[model samples]
Every structure is written in structure tokens, then in C-alpha cells.
Target: MTQGHHLRGIMLASVACMLWGISGVAASSLFAMNPDVSPLWLTQVRMIIAGIILLIMAQGVGAQPLQLWQNKYTATRIVSYALLGMVPVQLCYFEAVKYGNAPVATIIQFLGPFIISLYYLVFKRTKPTRSEAIGMVVAFVGTLLIVTHGHLNSLAISPAVLIWGLLSAVGVATNTLIPRPLLTKFGSLSVTGWGLLVAGVCLNVVKPLWQVHLTLDWAQISMLGIIIIFGTVIPFQMFAHSLGYILPTEASLLDAFEPLAATVFSVLFLSVQLTGFDLFGGALIIFAVMILSLDAQTLAVLLHRRHSRNTD
Candidate 1:
């Protein structure tokens, strides 16, 4: 790929992570504003509304949003991606946030990248570039610092909450791995639009929308709206599109930015306290991305023993 395309992919993925972070803050606001809000119902609404709007937009953009269903194979993949990938990701992350808190949820959810990396290593028989290996390590340390506020043992863990968090991570991996062919063949907008729509429709079978009701005030409405547009629709499109331009692992590593965005938003809008650890952690995350982006392959080969081993 050209350098310009790589830059574009990096930019899209980074921006998507930022918006997702902001959405995390927004979703947290919904929980605080009204404890009665159902996680299931909230997820259903976000997916359905965002999905419907995206389909319309996809059609307007001539993406042939309905064409995937014309072939049985593509149609089956669509359904699998929706039910197994999108549905679990959207719902599990919400449940994690609802129970364990966003910071805990985010760190756990990032396990997706590791899963992706390992998949490539074992199943695909590909080694990570030296810079990528280093970046993953840096990102993990940075994430831990940010989420734990430099206190690793400070987190309060519940069994169910932990399970939900882990599932969110698996969902992330599933979402990233399952849709590559479809995204390459179809493009991000239509796949994501249809994926969300299918997930919403399928979920409705078990948790019918009419079965749940809750109080909705303007604050709740605004938050929900933010989650739908900024959180659900826009970021997924950018993330999916970025995959066409960059490796899935690169996109996953850049996801470290999400926690940083969430931390900043929480401090600025939610009156949460920010500490030096947060700043240092955020800086490390950025530094990790910089490390991953460097084009100095020869230097990496000289510095990383694994490269020499592979060469041997």
C-alpha cells in the first residue's frame, strides 16, 4: 500500500477509537442518569436505530446495501457476523460497563488484540513485526496504568462482571476477524449497516423491544442519540474501513486510544479526577502508536532478536 493510504487508515482508526471512548463516557452517563435503564433495551435501541439510518445512508451512497443477501454464502456470513460478532460486542461491552465500570471493561475488552495477534501467529503462521511486538507491550502497560490509576490491585472484581468483560474482548476479536472478506468485498458502510440491522432484528426475537419500557428524559435521549451516531454508526464504519487499508492488529493496537479518550471525557464532563498516571499512560499509548508506525525495518531487525531468529 502507498504511504498515503496507510496514513489515511491510521487516521480513520484513531478517530474511531476516540469517538468510541467518548461514547463510553456517554453510555456511562446514561447509567448514572437513570439506574432503571436496561442494558439489553439500550443496546437494542442503539443497534436498531443506528442500523436503520446506516442502511438508508448506504443506499443513498449506492453501496447496494441489500445485495449481500442475494447470495446464500454472503448472506450466511452476514448473519453469523451479526449474531456472533456485532450482537455480542455491543451487548457484552454495555453489560461490562453496567457492572464492572468502563475502565475495567476497556482493559479487558482490549484482549481482542492479543487474541488476533495469537491467531496470526499460530493459525496463520505469521510473526509480528518487531515494532508491532514492541507496540503491543507498550500499549498493554499503558492501558494497565491508565485503568488502575497506577494501582494494579485497586480494581474491585466480580465474577459475572469479569465474564462479561472477557466476552466483550472475544466479541472484539470476532468482529475484527470474521468480517474481513465481507469488508473487502462490500466496504465498511454496508457491512456495518447491515450487520447492525441484522443483530438488532435477531436480538428482537429473544428480547422483543415491546417487552421493555423505561423512563426517557431529555438527558437520556441526548445520551442515547450520542451513542447511536457517534458510538454505534460512525466509529464502526471507520474501523471497518481502516481494515481495508491496514492490518487488523494495527487497528487493534490503536484501540488503546479509546481509554485515553474516555479518561479525558470523564474528567472534563463528569467531574472525575485525573492524575499524573493518566497523563503518563496516555502519553505511552501515543508513543506506542508512534513506535508501531515507524518504517525503519532494518533497525527493527537489528534490535529485535526475534527478527534475527526468523531470518536464520
Candidate 2:
């Protein structure tokens, strides 16, 4: 792609990450306002509503979403993607926020990018260069500072919240990686639409939405719309589509924006306090992202792609 297109893809991914950050704050607010709203139940609603809207949009763009069900193998993979990646990611994030707070949950989930890198190293035998290794260490230290706040003996939250937060990170990593081939094959919109639909249906079976009664005022209803549309649908579509243009590692690095957005929104809206250590930790994390962003190999790839496109 041209440099202009590359920049546009980065912008899209950045905006998507910011939206997800806002989503974390919004979901946390919903849980606080409506104590009766179960996380899984809310997730079910988000998946179904966003799924339908996204599927409709995909069709509007002339994408054949029905192709997802053309074969048993494809159908099964889509279902598994929903079950293993999308559903868990959303539910675990909401659960973490419901149990603890946004900043902690978001910071923990930020570990997903690094986890993706490590997974490649361990399983795929992709060795990290010196800069990437340093970046990983910086990210780990940043996470330690954010969670422990310079103390190791005590954590900032309960054990359950920590567990849920870690699960959210895993889900994020899985969500980013698993749908890649599907995105390449079916396009981003179709894969996301069908994945969300499958996840919604299965989650609804587990926790029927009809069983829960949510009394939403205008504000709550509006928040739900934002959650479903801007947060879930728009961001998912943007991130997925950007994956077609950018590397997965670049996508993960862009996700560094999410926690920063979450922290700002949480402090502003949820009245969460931001300490000096918090700022320091966040800077380290961003710096790690920059390390990868400025990597020689990554830059070479970008130049190569841009050159190839120009010649073509």
C-alpha cells in the first residue's frame, strides 16, 4: 500500500482502539448504574444487536455473509471463533470492570499485545530481535507498575478481578489472531458479523436475555446504542478491515491506545484516580509500542509494501 494508505490504516486502527477504550468506560458505567444488569446478559445483547447491524452493513456493501455457512468446516470454525475468542473477550472484560474498575481491567487487558508477541516466539518459533525483547521487558515493567504501584506484596484489586482481567487479555489476543485468515477470505465485515451472531446466539442460550429485565432510562438506552454501534460494531469493523492493510503486530501496537483512552475516560467519568505511578506505567507501555513502531524490520516491510504498490 502507499504511505497514505498505510497512514489511513493506522488512523483507522487508532480510532478503533480509542472507541474500545470508551467502551470499557461505558460498560463500567452501565454496571454501576444498573446493578442488576448481568455482564453475560449485556454481552449477549451487544453481540446480537451489533451482529445484526454489522451483517446488514456487510450485505449493503455486497458482501455475502451467508458464505460463512457454506461448509461444515467453515461454519464450525466461525462458531469456535465466536465461542473461544469474541465472546470470552467481551464477557471477561465486562466482568473485570464489573468486579473491579476500568483502569485496572484495561491495563491488564493491555497485556494481550505482548502475549501475542510471546505466543509467536514460543509456539511459532518466531524469535524476537533485541529491540522487540527490550520492548517486551518495558511492557512487563509497565504492567507491574500499573498493577502493583511499586509494591509487589499487595495487588490493587481482588484475586477474582485479576483472574478475570488476565482472561480478558487472553481473549483479546485470541480475538486479534484467530479471525485473520477468516478476514482475508470473507472480508472483515462478514467475518465480524457472523462471528458476533454466533457468539450472541450461543451466549443467549447460556444466559437467556429474556430472563433479565433491564429498566433503562433515555441515558441508559443511548449508552447501549453507543456500546453496540460505535464501540462494538464500528471499532470491530475498522480494526478487522485495517488488519487487511497492516501487520498483526502493528494492529496490536495500535491497541496500546485503548488503555490510554480507558484511563482518561475512567478518570473523567468514573471518578477513578490517576496516580504518578499510573502515568509512569502508561508511558512505559506506550514507549514499548513505539519501540516496535520504530523497528528497522517493520519499517523495511512498510517501505517494501509501499514500493511494490507504487510499481504495480
CA lDDT, every model vs. true structure: 0.76, 0.81
TM-score of each: 0.77, 0.87
Candidate 1, residue 280: lDDT: 74
Positional deviation of 230 in candidate 1, in angstroms? 1.5
Each model's RMSD to truth, in Å?
A: 6.4, 4.9
The lDDT, on a scale of 0 to 1, for candidate 1 is 0.76
| Per-residue lDDT of model 1, residues 1-312, tens digit only | 999999999999999999998887888789889998867888888988998988888888888988989988778888889988998787998898787556556656756655555566677576777876887798788766766776778743565666887788779877866665676567778888888888988888877998877889998899999999999788988887887898765775677788778777877887765567756765676676556646334323333444234335
Estimate, for each residue in 215-239, the C-alpha lDDT of model 2 and write its tens digit.
Answer: 8988888778788988998898788
Candidate 2 positional error at 81, Å: 1.0
Top candidate on TM-score is 2
Q: In candidate 2, which residue ranges exceed 4 Å CA deviation?
A: 1-7, 241-252, 293-312
Off by over 4 Å in 1: 1-12, 121-155, 238-254, 273-312
